[model samples]
Target: MYAYYGKEKIRMQPLHLLMERGHSCKLADIVKKCLRLDLLEKVTMKKNSALMMVVLLLMAVVLTGCASDDNQAATRTITDMAGNTVEIPASPQKIATMTGPSYEMVFMLGGKDKIGLVRSDHATGYPLALLTNSDLPNYPTIKGVGPQTPVNAEQFLDAGVDLVLYYNNAAELEKFKMAGIPAVVVNTTTTVPTTTEEYFEQSSANLKLLSEILGGEAVERYEKWYAYLTKNVELIAERTKDIKEEDRPVVYWGNTWGTNILSSYSRGTRDFEMELCGGTLVAPQEGGQFPEINKEQLLEWNPDIIFVDNHGNAPELVIEDMYSNKNWESLSAVQNKQLYRIPSGVFFMDKGSTNTLVLLWTAKVLHPDLFADIDMIKELQYYYSTFYDYDLSEEEAQKILEGWVDAENLVR
Candidate 1:
């Protein structure tokens, strides 16, 4: 703080004061009573609107004195993914997030210090919390919690969380709103990112928007993630550009463990992944986003390649079902052993900043020549270490490539 006594402006440490009732007054009146008339008379002033406005506002503030930083909090408004207009702290010190893809994004963008707590849904643990050096599990937990879960207002307040990053928790979000606690919906990843292009666009948009709330180091992390995504996407595109749809291999993918209830990506993000990887997704023509086709339909399609989502909590069971089922033996993908699984980690490689890695992995499996020289494990090491600050062991990288997780070692 600076004050004018007579001629020179002297710097003064601000003394915190409680705002008195009716302390605020009109601008002209404040300038008349508060400011040193001699200082104003001697000082040269700017005539611009911006400078004049600042001068007036500062003058008013000067007269009113000041309050603690907490009493004069800085904030801004943003429309969240759920279309809720929320005002959040300009620089949030403590944050709470639902653990999964959203929490993973928060950890990558901003480190774990600001993250004071986590809300768990299924599996009762956060992927990063279980796997990383951040000791995520040590943070207090609102365990087995979600939208329908009871809103524990006292728990949040006690944890000192001023900002919250949520996904699929409408009930809790409403509670926070009513309590005047600022919570922003961050759907960093879900089943939404289906195609490579959509993946980049959605992930970039998420990072850019979230960084504005997290601020500081988050922006730098986003730049790194975006640049890496662009380079990988372009490399894949350039190599597979000339391939035609009919020439591509037939592909099928399932998020779950069993093949009994067969599912595949339609004309959505998953379909684009097939195209991006130089393959064609084969599924029922008319059912829905995730059309469940039967054995007869699977026999008809006889997909040349199959990709399983290993991050969906049951990869081992899913892979076992695929290999042991007699009905699957007749398929081209199974006979040729072209079956591959999606990478798993803090967030599935299919979404968030890891989406480009999915494209790279899928392309490598579908068209080996395109990514012949690529070291997928090496890439994973760099990405994980740089973004999350978590070291990726070569052994673990191999498992990620194979879409396998030693669940007992990582998750409780």
Candidate 2:
């Protein structure tokens, strides 16, 4: 005999085992035998012993059905950026972002409550996190997990992580697979885009992939963000397309890491942003993405405008040093007071979602007369309110544009 527990089949044993070998017996015979032995009356004198047996059997079947349901966890399959097919939880409760920027991306996608771990370097100090979430300081962080560092799967497992977001790291992906953890690569492109079309395509792909993973409101937000990005990119491109080559200013975008001020992005999105905003990149494309040029080379280039990337050091301090340094005295940017600091929020304006804002800001800076109607403060406020769901006052928006950090909320 068999009993069906939902979709599962449970084999039922014969009741004749309760009787002598080779003897036939019905359910009533077993109940009668139990009642006669006083087994059924031990707890209470039940007039319906057969009914009690039927009730107990029904409870057992229900419990077995529940047990079967517990064994089947809900999941969904997705192909990551690196072409790896991964099965992840339908709604991950504990998400660990191995990449620093991805932490902000996930937070922006309305998955802040699902975030269980974040990169330690970008955990507490980000202006976006401070402005948006008051509880950001208490979020858990893991150190030494990024593109250069090897992934430690055990640490993530110990933290009860249900999903992991990472960049292109095959070894790390394999490690997560071996540990039975679902990892998704979120990189937009494997290589730097050489053209404007390629850049937008890659950027769009990145946002779409993230939205697909974190569905619901994330998909709606992605559409809004991409539309805004497209609008600004087209606006800038249209305005700058007709500008004469001789009229374009030679611009230099440098990063400030420790005492090094000449470390600049030679190509990729930064270069495209500069060119699209009526500025010619002073650094050659062949020099690689992040190359450190010497003082002599910088003097030779003598860019008209200098934009300092506030990476490891404060932008104001780096600009102040450049103004005081004897070697930079002859540079046209310093002499003309054209040195400007790139804006930062959740992430640096040069990268991530803020890149759109940077494009608009850069166009206004390079060609003030042409883009006189562009109000960056209002734009900043709108972006924060629309995407981050946080209202920013004029003062707070100005502070972010000036690259100001809240020291009280900042962790290192």
Candidate 3:
């Protein structure tokens, strides 16, 4: 968390306190408070009526005094994929993050204090204190990504956020711009980045952009995160370098649905760690996307080891059903009993800061003979602490992963 001395304190809680004091607070007053804190640049109101303008100006004056940053804050205008120009705020105070994982990224980027509101689904695991506590104002929920529910422009407008962050197809910028919200789009949907360099570069660019939005001490803290991750990656690369290409195992990734989707170290939807650890995928099919292979293909390729992404406890039933079939038994991984469940916190998340850590930990796990000192639980606690600033006890982290497995069982 950033220091409490600045304008952040007002956005964080003082508004609720003012309301509780029996004074009816208006949004203009809050924006004034924001401006007084030097949080927002004063702009002439073109749409609001004169009466509203007086109230807003007063509020802006009050808020302008709240911002304490003495440094010359950085500002920039970046174009979205759709070519819309977005003028990013310097030290944005109230940011609405719509994408579920964008919340996680904001927290990782040291914008936890800057986050004014999060989408509903992202708030699922939020503690009661953030919402139910009378001392805090009720935060509005923005929309999320997926098929039916894309970004909600009205919700963004209603939130009055200075900036909005989400992960969506760049093509959806039109939907985003309709809200008149300056959005930062993190495109993680790209299933296959051409190379690991491209992947890290993209991820770092997102982090850098977010860090720029959250300047001052937040940027310093975020840099610490970058340093920590860089050190870890270097350690992982050096540790796994000894494992030769020929000696590396051919592994297949399985899910709870008894599906064996072949993975590769080279590129595509293949696990990123598999590539880092020199592991090759068995399926030799072209177009290395996540394709569902049948039992016949499983027998034909016969991967050396199987790593199930499913954290479900009794996924063994699905394993049993597959192994019971004669064709599945013919596979090398099935014959050797080398199949194991990959830890969910790392492999389970599709994309996030946690996903990157999972990649490092997975590289260590896949080549334990060469990287025997790898500690997944320790790594998890470190990532959670360093990035999210949330410490998880061993038991707690285990419960989350096991809980995921249990939930999958219930679904089955």
Error of 3 at 48 (Å): 14
lDDT of 3 by residue, 33-144 (tens): 6455353343333333542554575465434533432133323577543344676655567787655456666766666667777665444433311322222235565444
Model with the higher TM-score, candidate 2 or 3: 2
Best prediction by TM-score? 2
Alpha carbon lDDT at 53, candidate 3: 53
**lDDT (CA) for every model shown?**
0.66, 0.73, 0.55
lDDT of 2 at 257: 72
Residue 192 in model 1: lDDT: 56
Report RMSD for candidate 2: 13.0
lDDT of 3 at 227: 74
Q: Which runs in model 3 stand beyond 4 Å of their true positions? A: 1-75, 79-85, 125-139, 142-144, 147-151, 189-199, 254-266, 269-272, 282-295, 310-327, 346-350, 400-412
lDDT of 3 at 71: 35
| Better candidate by TM-score, 1 or 2 | 2
Superposed model 1: Cα runs more than 4 Å off: 1-73, 120-131, 147-154, 168-171, 188-199, 257-267, 283-293, 404-412
RMSD list, candidates in order: 12.0, 13.0, 9.8
What tens digits encode model 1's per-residue C-alpha lDDT throughout 1-412?
3444465554322122112211223233435644566645654433445434645765657455434433555566888776778887666666777635666677788656777677643123334436664466567666655545667766776566667777647777877766445788766334456556676776577667777777788888888888987888778878887998777888888655343336654555666666767888775555654567677877887888877775445666766776888977898887888777778766666766677778888888888886798889898899888987879899988867766554443332
